[model samples]
Target: MYEYVRNPSLIHEGPLSKARLPVFLVHDGGGTAFSYHLLDRINRPLWGIENAKLQDGGWWDGGVPAMAAHYIELLGKVMPEGGDILLGGWSMGGLLSLEMAHQIALTAREAKNREGEAGDSGASTPKAPIFRVRGMIFIDSIFPLRLAELVGPLPEEPVFLSAEESRKMKLKDKVNLNMTHARMMVRFWQVPQWKDIPVPPTILMRAKEFVSRDSDENFVDYTRDLRLLGWDQYNEDHGHFIRDLWEVNGHHFSIFDIKYLDDVTRKVRKAADKLDPPDF
Candidate 1:
């Protein structure tokens, strides 16, 4: 049923158990899910969504919405029926997760409306399974210009590989993967497209180190910017989907570094617990 996942190599399965919600993580701009290997110790079922663009070479045209739609379809097949799952991503993946959550919400609402209409008309319709996104976790994800403006400028250095490092690494495929996702990300932010969707409860894990020197000099902080963006607005308006900010040691890319793996895992575990308390 999950035909979209043509490349099984993309998914890294961790320990599975019915006692806890499975966490689905999207890859960063580079489109590699391996970066999240450090999180494997969380001891809950973990699945990483790889960059299908690399496998199918068809992601260039649709932008973020299309990407989200594709993943939503794949997720529906993989996730347990009526189970609330945790969705998240790092960097560009984080942005993708948010978009996916929005699309999921829209889908659920439409499904509910259809069921209501069917009942009113006395028509018997088979109900489709609903996919529930319990919460969202963004690891240094990007936002719209309205939010970016508050943080001032960010660093231009490549998060996955530096220019010199790319040459030394001699991994053209990886480089191309990064560029492809970066282009999509740029296209996504070209206009303020996302609007008026119910966002789920979210946790923003911020890297304490600045992305670049200028941000350090200017004292610009993305976490601070997120706060200014009125993250609490959703909670105030709907009494749900409250946003929480957490500061971790390292830069955007380094947060996944081995030295900080424990911290990252702990924070993710905490977020998961908050979203779905353990059955024990």
Candidate 2:
């Protein structure tokens, strides 16, 4: 039941050209594609992967790897044959994007190895990959941690007791959907060590205000851990190349708010433009 928005309108002026690869975006935890309506400001093809769970009789029961695989299949259908692609997402969607990039890289590697073997064995190799991820963009996304740490506590009164009930419930309430997504995130993190793999040219648009101000006595800054553990290691291991981080105004959610839409779109477009084909 997942819906794909093919010709999404741009918030600012300018039409997307067919020559360039479209940027595929995953929805935030609220499972709302409209949440990213502001990104239309970027003068490029934009595709939003609407959450299947939000639709009646849709399927999405929490598992980052599974979710990534599902999207990869969908991506193949939309992208041109052997074309380049850009992947990005906000919040929980960002984490999903990272995973998708990793899977794409793995698949590409496998294809390359197959081609090499074919060359050696005098066999016909496939012309090119179905699609290659050119860049990855993360908007205020953090590395995964325990659910209890991320969200204080689970609600005592369950909104949708069962998947069947969730399917039946109206998707009008954003709060309800957010709560459901939060639980799914918790479950996603509970799975055994789902670490991030090295991706293509990447950029992280961090919300400075939110991470700086919002801190309870016991709150641990996962973003700090991301800088130290994820970003730092990635740079060191990859020769200090292919990654950029920019601090933007507003809180985590508000960074994508209408007031900062122009700023956000500009940064994203800049990052996407900077991407180069991955060197095997």
Candidate 3:
């Protein structure tokens, strides 16, 4: 794994008001997270985590597991008296949030084990607070491991990128760091059996349309199937993990537009409110 100092910086910090717990949002493949600032912050503080190498002149040397481990440690200090927190991520960030939640659960397990050992010595369970995952919001994240199962093996052409995306990507090709983050994303495909960890309530928001003028002919054709954008089989085979499937107002890329992003933020807060425990 590529080693770096305490660099994957936390980019956002909210009010000290513990009245409504904070939400930590992770960055997607492009590796920056400022867009989350657009989220509605009615009663919550929003925090963002971004890859240091992408912006700070280094590179992510490892895979998702390593990334998760590093971020969890940072969060442990950043929110020491950890309490319930809502987790949200866009695209690749969604998969990241799940891994993070699993990591948090691991910490809880370790805490429980320590208390067990103390109890044997006639001591009570520790009351120290630790971070807990209250809920998750996935903005069109499709885990790698499930892609094959959801859509069958993809064709050789892949058709993963639309014309607009292809055009934007050509520009990024000139930047080495962009390619680095792209490569890092490929390593996130494998599924880890995070056994024994509870699945927090989740909501997945998808785009209303899929298209672009410059999109490949194959991609344009692929869009016709819709499958509601590859969600039909998912709802049938893996619906249990997600509590709700939200078809938002914009397409995958446009979901972040101020107009639609506001809706996304509002719904996230509403859902988080229901899942998060009362601060009392």
lDDT of each: 0.65, 0.61, 0.61
Q: Can you tell me which runs of candidate 2 are displaced by over 4 Å? A: 1-18, 56-62, 118-129, 146-148, 154-175, 186-198, 211-242, 276-280
The parts of candidate 3 lying over 4 Å away from their true place are 1-18, 56-59, 121-129, 146-176, 179-184, 216-239, 277-280
lDDT of 2 by residue, 221-280 (tens): 455445532456544665443378887777666777888877887877776666632222
Q: Higher TM-score: candidate 1 or 2?
A: 1
For model 3, how does the per-residue alpha-carbon lDDT over 38-93 read when each residue is reduced to its tens digit?
A: 77664656677775444332234466767777777767666656678888787667
Model 2, TM vs. native: 0.73
Q: Which one wins by TM-score: 1 or 3?
A: 1
Backbone clashes (count) for model 3:
3
Best by TM-score: 1
Off by over 4 Å in 1: 1-18, 56-58, 80-82, 126-128, 146-173, 180-186, 189-197, 214-242
Among all candidates shown, the one with the greatest lDDT:
1
Query: What alpha-carbon RMSD in Å does predicted model 3 have with respect to the real structure?
Result: 7.6
Please write out the lDDT profile of model 1 over residues 1-280, one tens digit for every residue.
2223442223434345445677888877677677776674565766788776644332445676777778876776674354567889887777778777777777788888888998899887765557778898878664544543443343443234455655565445664645455554554454313356556778877777766755532222444455523344534665455467787778776788989888888888787777777775
In angstroms, give how far residue 2 of model 3 lies from its true place.
29
